[model samples]
Target: MKVGFIQFSPILGKPTQTLERLEYLIDKGKHSDILVLPELCNSGYAFNSRQQALNSSESVADSKFIRFLHEKSNKYNLYIVSGFCEKSDKDLYNSSFLVGPNEYIEVYRKSHLFLNEKDFFSPGNTDYSVYDIGICKIGMLICFDWVFPEAWRILALKGADIICHPSNIVLPDLCQKTIPGHSICNRMFIVTANRIGTEDNLTFTGSSIICDPRGNILTQASDDQEEVMISDIDLNLARDKSITSRNHIFLDRRPDKYLDIAKAIEESV
Candidate 1:
């Protein structure tokens, strides 16, 4: 399958212009089987206040951005994963949605809030989940959740062939290193779509990447530019968790022995 990601800078409080730019990128990536966009691709990140975030948020069911994705997915016969500020009822969430040729597949709220996000968005209630997209079993996780190893492990355990990571990353080295680690350990493919440029003085690191199960970087973008990176991968390669003839990444796990890890970390905090 052909998987691709778009890296671009989103202007704050300008959803229309952002969507137009994203539409152009999506058009450029129409040949890809699956495409991903950066976190908060529509409304932009780095909100000045809670009211500003709320003002910029929209419901997934009625969002112009989502509606455009639906149309484009149907037109191109592609699957799309994108991040946006989601408004459900009165609460807001840092969320990403998976849309296929059929329509909406699933929405993943950001599980781990970062920095000032706690003041504007609610933590995701849904645990790590995977969905079937005909070609592969895909999982979704937003920015900041990459810091939690458990999130990646859970998705791996749930039979995820590919993990779609939509991010607005500030720390370049962390994601650049961690995403390959997640792919190598889980023995699954990882596609990370990160934004570029600055918002409210917070500059995003834009090294968007697609990594194979063996931790090889299939395609990577530049740190400071807007670009689309694409790669063709075999979904069957991720199905086997065995690292070698004697080692199996999943079968070798000792979950029973590591039960105290979370508790110990919580106590230390």
Candidate 2:
């Protein structure tokens, strides 16, 4: 399967302009089977107040941006994963949606809110899950979720072939160094779609990348550029989790000994 991501600077508070940019990028990525965009691609990040975040948030069912995405999906015959501010049941959440040619596949809320996000957005209620996208079993995760190794591990254990990561990254080289490790540890493919340019006082790091199951960077974008990076990946590589003839990544786990790890982390939190 060919996977790709668009790395672009989104103008703050301009959904119309941002959608236009996204549409253009989508058109450019027609050859890819799956295309991903940065987190909050519709509404830019860095809201000053709760009211501003509320004003930008929209229900997925009623969102014009989502309708546009559906149309693009049908027209291009590709699966798209893009981030947006979702409003549901009078609450707002930083979310990403996976849209196919005919219908919405899944909605993944950013489970680990970063910095000021907790002030305006509710924490994700959905657990880490994978979907059968015909070509592969795909999983979705947002920006800050990358920090949690458990999140990626859960997805891998669920038999995810590819993990789509939509991020509006601001901290320097954190994602660049962290993502490959997750792919290596889990023996799964990872596609990170990160944004570029500065918003308010935050400077986005646009090193969007696609890594193979063995942790090799297949393709990556520049730190400060609007780009569309595409790479053809073999899904079979992810399905086979064996590191060597004698060891398998998943079967070799020592879960019995680390059973208290989750409880320990929860207590710390």
Model 1 pairs in collision: none
TM-score of each: 0.97, 0.97
Q: For candidate 1, report its TM-score.
A: 0.97
Model 2 Cα lDDT, one tens digit per residue, 43-151: 8899999899989888988998888888999998999999989999889999999999877568999999999999999999988989898888889999999999999
Q: What overall lDDT goes with each candidate model?
A: 0.90, 0.91
Q: Model 2 — TM-score against the truth?
A: 0.97
Clashes of each: 0, 0
Residue 176 of model 2 has an lDDT of 83
